[model samples]
Every structure is written in structure tokens, then in C-alpha cells.
Target chain A: MNGAEKIRVENLTKFFINGKTAVSALENVNLTVNDGEFLCVVGPSGCGKTTMLRILAGLEKPTSGRVHINAKAAGVPSTAVVFQGDSIFPWMRVVENVEYGLKLRGVPLKERRAVAMEHLKKMGLERFAYLYPYQLSGGMKQRVNVARAFACDPEILLMDEPFGALDEQNRLLLQQELLRIWEENCKTTVFITHSIDEALLLGDKILVMTAQPGKVKALLDVKIPRPRDIILIKSSPVFIELYKEIWDLLKEEVLKARNIK
Target chain B: MNTTEERLSQNRASLGKEFWLKTFSFLSPLFLLFLWEALAALKLVDVRLFSSPSRIFKTLIPLVLSGELIYHTLISTMRIALGFLAGAIPGVALGLSMGLFPSVRALLMPLVAVTFPIPKLAIMPLILIVFGLGESSKIFTIAIGVFYLVLINTMAGVLNIDPIYIDVAKSFKASRIQFYTTVAFPGALPMIFAGLKLGMGTALLLIVAAELSAAKAGVGWMIWRAYDMFDIERMFCSLIVLAFLGFVFSYLLDFLEKIVIPWKKR
Candidate 1:
């Protein structure tokens, strides 16, 4: 918790214009993420968690206010995002996908290949290095996506429910895999998810957001110890209490969103 | 163990079916040839008007032996290759520019829309006048036809690429050249191949039309000359040669597609 401030979002707001109507996706979102912290934002389906992550990733500009990354130097990218769906390039094999970031950074082929192979190995994807994305299962493809993000070695990792599309079993497996990788890399991560248990399992601190014109509803620091087993954490009393508290905050937003729909 | 055996037997059965399918496909064409021969032998069709496959082959063999067939084929092939290159290269370049830059699209899209639907053959007279009654005219006719086909398809290919891929590339901070080579070009390849396949067909069709209208030598010219002399067998030979060339060109494109876009196959 004593780590230096790695990212700051101040009075950040986003408005999407459709014809004459403007839809507020996020409103006055303000937060600070410490270096190497794994922060999860949990909210209802339309709570603009993705828009927040996109702003952090620099894919979307805030209508007002600013996001500041404490970059070590100028002209260096400080963030990478793992999108919600299958964002792995189907035309590329596993190795190529992992090497894409390094290649863009003008890394030599030999060096990039070694780095990519190392990440693929860590993801247990060494054997499928030459295989195309379409040949893999949803779980395996998500693994590739994670490997690609981590291999980039960005200053911060912005993940928008990377495992949201998978079935429950695959989602749990990837969540564990993600935790293991994050534990090793310790990158400043802002992960957005709909699952309360997932937010509790992986995040150092959890931020729950309100529905539609989303605003931060609650921010709770998860006191769960490090090197935690996700399954074991689920059965713990403290885990259940935090889950219940976050669920209670989120349930109201979910209902409000549903009523609007 | 039972499931494994079942799967093995299923594989064998499919293999057997595939073998029979291949045999039937080969036999079907041979059967048509035999039927044609039978009809011609029994004089069921007038030999003068409808030459038998055998008489066509007899005329084809002598022409091929005398190198006349090769000469015409080479001339036609050269025109097609040169014209396809001239049109396809510029077409892809312009298409990429149009797809990438809104200004280019706005400027040229109207011109493309107007001319693309006008059949290339209809403008043969204009092309002939502009390039003169020679190889230039023939090549120009084919090039113009191929250009439109390639340009339209390439533009669509670039436009149709999933914007998500572009976002990924942008996130990686890929340079413009890298964006095209690694993302846009490869991403648009399947569609581009579709365009190239279409362009190849148009090239063959336009070349034949061009040769028919104005050319000293080509399969089309030979066919035209044979018709004028009332040589049915020679005309049939030329038609058969043209058919073979079309098949070869299409097959070559398929082979190239397989090579360039290997990721398409599982």
C-alpha cells in the first residue's frame, strides 16, 4: 500500500454523442493506483468500467480532466490493454502475437523471439507457439491474449474482463493463471470485471462503480494475504464478508441498470 | 477402445467415399468425351458444323507441333501477365490510399463508381483508337478491366478489416508502414485474394475480347481467322486452348493464394 503513485485519474469524464443526444459513460471518475498494484473495478453491465479502462489505456480521451501516468521517460508507452473478446490476431501464430509488441518497439527478431518464447512458456503455450489463434480453444486464446499483454512489459496493464467471454470453468482457470502471472510480474494493473468473486480473488483493492453515467460507488482494500489460492480464498470468512459487502453495493446498481433497460 | 475403433472406421469410410467421389469426377468428364465421339462417329451431329473431339485434337496436335499454338498461347500469356501486373499493382496502391485516406476516397470514388460498371469490352473501340491497332491496345484493354476489378476489391478489403485489429496496432504504437505490412495488408489478404481471383478472370475475358477486336496473333485471333475460313476443327482447337489457359490461370491463382495466405487453412 506504501508504493509510489503510478497512475492518477482526476475528474475524468466521458460522453459518447449519438446524433443530438449525449450519453455519459463515466462521470467524475477519480482514483490513484500505486505502482505494482492489482486494482479491480467491479460494476453492473453498463457501468462504464470499460470506458474507464480505455481512458487509462489511452484508447479513448476523457471529455474533461486528465489521466497522468508517472512514466520514467518521454516517448515511452506506459500502458497495454487486453480487450474483452478475442483480440488475438487470427492471422498470426502464437509466437508472432506475443512478439508483436516487441517488434513494434524495433526489437531485433532474435531478441523478440526469445522474449516471446519465454512468455509463451510461462503461459504454458510453448508447444502451441506455431499454431494460429483460430486453432485454439477460447481458454487457450485467452491465454495467448494474456501472454501478449504481459510480454509487452508495459508500465501499466489495463485488462477489460479478458476472461469474461469464457465459461465458468475456463474463467476460473484463467483467473488463476492471470494471478500467477501478475504475481510474478507485479505490473500496475487496472482490471475491470463483472464478477464480484473475481474482483475479490485477484485485486489488491476493489473499486465498485454505479450504473449508467457511472461513478465510483465504493472502494475497498482487500486485506487478503499474498500467494493466496483463489479457491481457498473463496471459502474464507473474510472473503465471504467482502464479497457480500461488494455484492450489496453492486446489486443496487444492477437493479437500477435493469430498470432503465 | 471402442470409441477409437469407431473413429478409425469412420475415417476409413470417409476415405472410401472420397475415393469414389474422385473417381466419379474423373469418369464424368471422360464419359462426356466418349459420348461426343460416339455422336460424331454415328453422324448424329453434322461433322462439318460440329467437329468431333478427335478431329479437334488432330488439328490441335499439328498446330502445336508446328509451334503455331505455342506462339499464340505465349503471345496471349505475355499480354495477360504484363497487363495484370500493370493494373493490379496500381490498383492495390490506389485502393489502399483510397481506403486509408478519406480525401482520396472522396476524390476518386465517384470516378470508380461511374467506370466500374461500364463493361471493359464496350470500350474496346476507344482503347483501340487510343493505343492503336497493336499489342498496346490489347494490353490496355485487359489492364483497364483488371484495374477496376482489383481496385474495387482491394478497397473493400481494406475497408472491411475489423477495426479492433487497427486498435491493437495503434495501442502497440505501430508505425504507418508497419501498420500496413503487418496489419492492413495481411488483414485484407483474404479479401484481396478474392479480388485478385476476380481480377484474373476479368483479365482473361478482356484479353480475349481485345484480341478478337484488334490483334495480329493470339488464340482469339486464331479462332476469329478459323471462323472466317470455315475451319470448324481449327476453331474448336483454339476454343479448347483458350479453355485450358483459363483453367491454368485460375489454378495458378489458387496456388498463389495457398502460398501467400497459409494461415487460412487449418
Candidate 2:
């Protein structure tokens, strides 16, 4: 059933023009995100992970090639994004920020409020619903970003390092919460992260991307069983072997990303 | 991430310091007034030319009771209201459109750049000739003065809004009107308020300049008449009233800003 393709990126290439020179960000990238599958992308910094997500979100047009998003659920919007930092409107209260997509969709106030409140509750932020984004901690603010994505209930959830700026503890905590929330009802999610552990913990398949002039280097499925966790997975041999294999694949790329001899 | 409760505690921690700050601000003006009175009482200064604070107040009560001051103040206030509204409405509208649409900005920017620095006061004679030195002329002058200030700030506010917010708006597929109304308007509000405050100040300034030259009835005209007759006390009294008006207008705008953008921390 998961064989059905949700998104297909064929020969995707993106170039940014800088002072009469075209700098390639993504070079002939091609990938597919299966329906209701959680695909995490791990890459070196400036690898055009964000650019790819933006293209997938339909916020940017591909310089070349094609991106096909099968919006199977008609009348339902296709994509919503969780940006890296401070994406929620500072002027809006927590609930308002969460309900923003619905508000744009012209959903009635009471109905959207109920949906936003429910998502906020899932993030343990129901108590902070009336507060402004300025009043939320970095960790809590990222949670608000997650809650908004969930509340929007788009067919595709595109996250660009939503927890990238958070401290270690908050990162693990939110990852656990995210896994729990997602496990309740699985949806097609594309999450970009810098951490291999994070990619393994959340994703069914991991796509490893190369350095600048980014291209798909490797794609591997996580064989580790579900109900896995940040700490619990550490003890599992399958998790350790998968972790070592990925680290080996990623270490060379990480060095190559820095142009290390 | 300062919550309301945390903010309250922080305020309490600095409560004594805040009190002293307010007290000092309040007392500094009174101290100056007292010193001026002392200089006048001792004949250390020319009372006839300078006029003591007491003499200014003495003249103020009669001006108020005789309805002369009230009538003039009302006229000036009315002109300010009319002109400020005229400028602010279109200024904000155009400013938002310009910031959101590059084409509108490109077309209007050259015109604004050329005309903005010519000095509205320099054009006052032309305005008077065109509008015939009536209320229309005074109101028109104030409007032009206010229009430029509000337009620039409001445009800057929209322009300064983080690009991320705009991208978020697009990802969600926000409608064109929604993009402007919900995203642009609220996002640019802080800058818009800055424009409004500056515009209000300009309105106050231009009202006086316009009324002094043209109007028969405003506080500025009253000051002009007092200056002509060498009634220094009446002039002092009118000046004090004008200062008071300025203070009131600034506080009113601050209050409105707080109400509109409550999410912003002080």
C-alpha cells in the first residue's frame, strides 16, 4: 500500500545566480517520497536541503526538472512547512499561530480553534495558547512550529531542521513527543536534520545528501523496530549497527563537505 | 521568552527604580519653572519680555474664561484632525501597496524622492494662493506634511518584515488580499505606528505654521496677534498651551500603540 508515490522529484537542479555566475545548489537530484512514509534527509550544511524542501513545499520553483506531488486527498491542501527558526508570527498568540493555515483556508473560527487547541494540547502547550510567540522559549517555540504543521494537516509535512537550534535535552524530548504524535496517525513527512541519530529515530528511510552542488549520495531504510527511542535505541544492536554504518557513510561526506584531504 | 508572570516579577524588582525615574522626569520641568519664577521675582531677568511662569498662568485663566483660548484651540484641533486623517488614510494604504508590490514602489519612489525634500513650507505660499487662505489651505498644508512622514515609515515597516514570514504565507497558499490584510498589515503595524506618531507630530507642527501665516482663528493666530501687540505674557500662555497639546497628543498615540500591538514587550 505504501508503494504508491506521494512525491517524485526527477532530475531536479536548482541554481542561484550570484554576480553573473550561476552557483548550483542542487545538481541533478532525484528522489521519491512514498505515501504515508516518514523520510528524513541528512546532509552537510549548505547542501541545499532547505532549497529542496522549499521546492517541495511549492514555495520555490525548480530551476530545471520536475516535482510531482500527488495531492490524493482532494480539497485538502497539499503541503505545510516547519521552518528552521522563528517561523510563527510574533504578533499572533499561540492558538492563532497554530490555526493560521485554517484561517487562510477560510475555515470558521470555532472549528479551527478546536483543531488548533487539540494540536496545542498534544504538544503540552494548551496552557500557553493565549500567550504570544515572544513569550515562548526556543524549545517551546519549535514545538509551536510542529503543532502548526500538524494542525494544518497537509498531505505532506515539510520540516527544515525544526529542532536544529534547540539544546540537547529539548531536542530529544521533542523528538520523543514528535514520534509519539506521529505514531498516533502516520502521515507522509519529509524532515531535514543534521543529526544522524535524529534521522534514524524519526524516519523509516534516510536520504544522505552530498556537499555543495548537493546530490543524493545514498538512501537507506532504518531496520530498527518501532516504539524506538533516543535512549532505548542506544542499547539495541540493530540500532548500533545501523548507526555505525550511517556514521561511516556520513563521516566521509562530512569531511568531503569541508574539503578535507 | 519572558512570560507575563515573569515580566510582572521583573517589574516588581525594578519598581523602586522605575518610580524614581518617573519622579525625576516629572520634577525636572517643575524645577525649571520654579527657577524661572525666582529669576523674574528678583528682577534678574526682563519680566516684560520673558514673562514669568506666574504671569503666563495669570493670563491663561482669563483667556480660557473669556472663551478666546477655547475657540482657537478647538479650531486648531479640528484642523489637525481633518488633516491628519487625510494624510494617514492614504499614506498607510499607498505605503503598504508600495512595499508589497515592487511596480507600485518603482513608479511612486521617483516622485516621492523628488517631491519629498522640496519643503512643504516652501510650497505654503502656493497652497495659500490656490486654497485662498481659508481653513482648506491650512488643512492642506498639514496633510502634505503628515503624508510624507507616515508613508515612509509605514513603507519601511512592510519592507522590514522578515522574509521568512512571507515565505510561510506563500507555502500556506494565502490569498492575495489575505497576504496584504493579515500578513502585511499586522506585520507592518509597528512601523506603521512609528509613522503615525511622527505624522501626528508633523500635523501639530504644520498646524501652527499654517495658522500663523493664514488662519484668523487658531492658537497659532492668537500667538501671532499677541506677538504683534507685544503682549509677551499672552504669548507665553499660548506657547504653554501648545506644549501641553503636544504632550497630550504624544501620550494619546502611545496609548493607542499599546492597545493595537499588545504582543510587543515594552
> Highest TM-score among the candidates is held by which one?
1
**Per-residue CA lDDT of candidate 1, range A60-112, in tens?**
89999899999885544688889889898988988999999988988899999
lDDT of 2 by residue, A60-129 (tens): 8899999999998776789989999989999999999999999999899999999999999999999999
Share of real interface contacts recovered by each model? 0.56, 0.83
lDDT of 2: 0.90
Candidate 1 shows a clash count of 0
Candidate 1 matches the true fold with a TM-score of: 0.96
The local lDDT score (0 to 100) that residue B195 gets in candidate 2 is 92
Models, CA RMSD each: 1.9, 3.7
For model 2, the chain A TM-score is 0.97
